[model samples]
Target chain A: MYQLIDPILVAVLLLNFAALGASQLRTVIHAIALQGVLLGVLVVVAHNEFTIWAVLMACAAITLKGIFIPRLLFHAIREVSIRREVEPIIGFIASLLLGGLGTALAVLFSNTLPIAQEHVGSLIVPAALSTTLTGFLILTTRVKAITQVVGYLVLENGIFIFGMLLVEAMPFLVEIGVLLDLFVAIFVMGIIINRISREFSTVSTRNLSSLKE
Target chain B: MLISQIIVHVVLLLVMPPLLLGVIGKTKALFGGRVGPPLFQAFFDLIKLFQKGSVISSTTTWVFRAGPVVGLATAILAGLFIPFGGHASPVSFSGDLILFAYLFALGRFFTASAALDTGSAFEGMGAAREVTFSCLAEPALFFGFLVLAKLSGSLSLTAMLDGPMPNSWGAAGASLVLVAASLFIVLLVENSRIPFDDPNTHLELTMIHEVMVLDHSGPALGMILYGAAMKLFVMCALLLRIVAPFDSGNIWVDWGIFAVGMLALAMVIGVVESIMARFKLTFVPTFLVAACLLSAFGIILLLR
Candidate 1:
């Protein structure tokens, strides 16, 4: 079970790169969905002992983050008719390099902090920081609202990864609450995207500045 | 024992490359639902090319001729530094990995220089694209080597790849997987395969490796084809050593396994070519950079 943890986490990290390097909004969404499913598996694997709560948590996570949220984003892309292009503010190559740099830094930064004895060799710290940094990168660098929403979801996935370290301290109910909050957040973002696209005839956040002054 | 292994390496290096190309062609044909050329078609083509006459352009210099010769020489030399299926390389030193890498570089330099010597704009463009793309690819190759060096604690290609490789896989499996992925990308790019450059395409504007050799004919073109196939073989051997680093205590069996692995890899390349469309010229650099990131991530994973 412990051996399974790092590979799943490493896969999640690779998906971070896939998202950063991808030009298609649909590709980015799939990457996040895959990351979500892998993380859901990580939730079960990290616990060592199988508990009813762990299994239940994995099921909810797999459904919401993996299936439910991504399905919402796919529909959003379809109805909004944003097509496939991500319209990044920076080039894909530059964004990929920056993502690499952030991941290296995340690993470096996590090395300095003291971690719990059992969690020391595990990739939990570096994976969490790296995933968060990747999410932040997507959020800041991309111009599309759908991409930004995907970025926000990725950022939240990073938090969920960190939350794995404190599986005991982080109550199952709290976990449920976090997932529901994310679900609601996406629900709101979807509505905003539909409304903005309907009003402006585009999803590029670059146009939103006209409301200023 | 060393002499025997070296003989086996030399024989395979000489004889096996064309067959690999044949396998790739046959695999692609199967995918396209046609009965392609026979499995030995590459060898027949090479024989025909060598028997044909040369047609040098009036504008060309000696560099145009030197390109294929130098390329073939370097590729054969590079093959010496790579172990064939757990057998130590014919030539191994503390820092042969650098030599191994630069041999390919030197080969590319000469090839590009030869293309420029022809003074044709299309060949020149192909040469420029080849050199430019290699700038990204060469570093990614080094990064993959870096992972191997760190894992095995040696700078030599033989030491970096042989014996305890299975153990290294056990300890650093994720990093190895990343390295394997990047190296596959490198292989495709370096050899000018489909998705990077269509080897089969003769259209000047659309090809890279084929376009550069527009002036070469007869034996020179044969040398280029043979060199390309051998380069693929060597690169595939490097990849195989990492992914399947097992020695069954019988030399013949080991060699057979390595040969089968090379054939399988050729077929896989065929499948990739069939399924994926070639990238636009502008996106090629982006693809190369992604390869760099893959290997860089391999190093990062190893650091932890």
Candidate 2:
């Protein structure tokens, strides 16, 4: 499990960059889905003991986060009838350079923390921090509402990775709450996108500024 | 024995490059599900090129003729610094990595300038694109050198490359992985391979490197082709030295490993070309910048 954890974390890091630099909306969504699936696997592997609940929880997380959310995002895009372009407030290169800088800072910051015995050598801390920073960068920098939602998914994935440290301490109810919040967010956003496409004939969040304060 | 080593190095650098191009062609052909050109087709093309007459333009000056000659000279010159397989480079000194790197730039400068000297807007367009992209790519290559410098605690290409012995791989494996990925992207962009610029594109408007050489013919063109092939080999050698740093403690065995590693690198390049579409021209800088950041991250990993 330890051997596998580092590689999985590295894959997550790479996916974070892939999402950051991607020019198309579908590529970002795909990177997010693959990342969600990897985190699902991490949930099982992070546990010290193989409980039946962990396996069941992993499957449920994988199904919802990996399959259900991406499918919803794809459906929203299809309904919106917009092109696959990723219109970023910050250019792709700028965002990518910032993401790299953030990853470096995250790694450096994690190095200074006084971690406990079991988690001392694990990469979860920096990977979690970097993944979160990348998600936030995307969320703030991308103009499209759908891409912003994709950023939200990545942000949650980072928080999920960080949760591995307190796997035993964190209650099952808390995980359920986070997942429930995500589901509601996406479900409502999907409807909103559909509604926006119907009313304005477009889904660019920039257009919403037309409504006065 | 030193003289013999130098002789072997010279012979290998001069002779083995065309075969790698052949392997790449063969691999791409296999991907396209067709019987490709023979493995020695690059050599055959070179011979056929040299046998023909060159139609030098009256409008063009001597710089036009000097381009291929300078390009080939700089490429093979830089090839002397890379430690192939387990063997030390024949010509290496402190700070030679910098020289090795700028040798590439020097080669590009001459090639692009020569393209401009042709007074053709077409070649000038290609030259502009080539020089502009190198501006992005140069930093990535330098960042990679920084990672190597940090890892090996050496400045010369020979020592910087040799530092990644099997033991160092364990200590700095993560950083090395980042460097390798970055270097691979640089190789593709620098060599004009597909996914950055396709070497085989027939359309002048689409291809950056090929378009620049369109005005040259016969022996001058052969030098450019041979130079391009050698450039590919030299870049692959630098990459393979880092990623596949294997040694058996025998000179003969290490040389054999090198031959096999170059073949593998060419095939891997072919696979990448086949699977990935050429990035949009606008997106090329984005990838190059990503390459820079990747290696920068690699260097950051060493801070701990």
Candidate 3:
């Protein structure tokens, strides 16, 4: 059961990194939604126990991450008329290179840590860590505010993957609370993007430089 | 008693904010030319403001009213897990640090949202800058925590501290120094101290954290100020745990040393604030990126 869940999650995480390395706005949001769905499926499959709460959590994940968020973001993208994150401070190739380096580092670092739990599956820690780094890479390197939001979502997803390793230990209430906070956070980011677009006439954070000393 | 732990955590989490501010202020004053106010000055100020009340902005909604409360609440809530002086945290579990870190992010997210809610360009600029720096700083801070967890064999801040001090000045010492440097940068940027944004800066155009709080007054202002200082205190405590000589058994000595260390650290921050000019806003990100590189180096050293 652990082995089956691990590879699919790793593959999804890698795709999430690949998405971060992409330049198009539409592609990035879609990738984020895809990540949400992948994570949701992973949750259900790994637990291998079908309960109403679990199903509801999975549904909530799909609604917020897979559908609602991307739809809201795409609307904002259309409203702002900005289709691409052009000329990110780091080029796509460079971001991908860093992403690869980060993945290698994550695997290497995880190997060094002493593991106490015999039943614990491999790959979760490294996958989560690399996905997190890739998300940060996108966040720092991108000029677009929208893209940064995507990066943040990816980062949160990576954290969620990390959380799955200790799902039994972590309270369901806390999980619910985290998901609620994340949904609200993304909603707030959508609002901020709208304001940024209207005020500066561009969603590119590069132009919001009027306040710098 | 579990109940007592809960009570103590709650009280400390709430009251310590103002006390932390007072300590920071008094230390800064001692470092400067003049005498500072009493150690309880922030506490007094809060009482005064709470009694006096506030004038709501016309441009704002319920978000404005709820923002400061949420910020303060979240800060106090996150504080519940920080584990003062090797006391077991009220909440502890796997990946608790992620919650610890993100709870602060939760406060920040709300604070930024509230800042943007005001529709003031100055506040918006401040929010943008805060989030931008946080984007870089959060990872560095986490990476540092990661290394500490790795070295110590535990992720809980308390357990990590409970682990053996990395013997000698090798990779462990290097990483400790690296993490401390990065966390200190976070303390500055997150707390809105000098070289990042001057807490006492008169100019709104040059402010990040301060500018966001410009429109807030009375108890709301009190909460923001208190929250930032307590956060600084928490970071100081984490640093002390890293550097302190005693292990978990000598709680009194460890805490006493922590308090004294925090006082000295506050004075150092004050002296730095007194002497240095705020960096150009663009340079703030550069500064944070430098911290990230340091943290990355620390991790690489640990791996090697």
Task: Evaluate all candidate structures by whole-model CA lDDT and list the values in order.
Answer: 0.91, 0.88, 0.75
DockQ of all predictions against the true structure, Cα-based: 0.76, 0.66, 0.02
Question: Which runs in model 1 stand beyond 4 Å of their true positions?
Answer: none
* lDDT of each residue in A1-213, candidate 1, tens digit only: 889999998899989989998888888999999999998999899887789999999999999999999999999889887765546788889999998999899988998889988888789999999999989999998888899999999999999999999987888999999999999999999988988898888888888877657
Q: Candidate 3 on B1-304: residue-level lDDT in tens?
A: 2676567656656666567667667767876766889999978887887777788789898887777888887777777777765566777776788888998898888888888889998898988988887888898888888888888778776676654653423435656776777788888888888889877775668787877877888888878877776677677667666665354466556556555665677767777777788887766765676566556656765664
Candidate 3 lDDT by residue in tens digits, A49-121:
8876667777887888898888988998999998888889987655665775787687788777775475333
The 10 consecutive residues of candidate 2 chain A with the worst lDDT sum are A78-87
Pairwise TM-score winner, candidates 2 and 3: 2
| Better structure of 1 and 3 per DockQ | 1
Cα deviation in Å at residue B26, candidate 3? 3.2
User: Candidate 3 at residue B137, lDDT?
Assistant: 84
Candidate 2 lDDT tens digits, B84-197: 876788999999988998998999999998999999999999999999999999999999999888878889888887746676688888878988999999999999998999
Query: How does candidate 3 fare on TM-score?
Result: 0.58
How well does each candidate superpose onto the true structure, as a TM-score?
A: 0.98, 0.95, 0.58
- What range of 10 consecutive residues in model 3 chain B has the weakest lDDT sum? B162-171
How far in Å is the alpha carbon of B173 misplaced in model 2?
2.2
lDDT of 2 at B270: 86
Model 3 alpha-carbon drift over 4 Å, by segment: A1-213, B1-10, B165-171
Q: Which stretches of candidate 2 lie over 4 Å from their true place?
A: A112-122
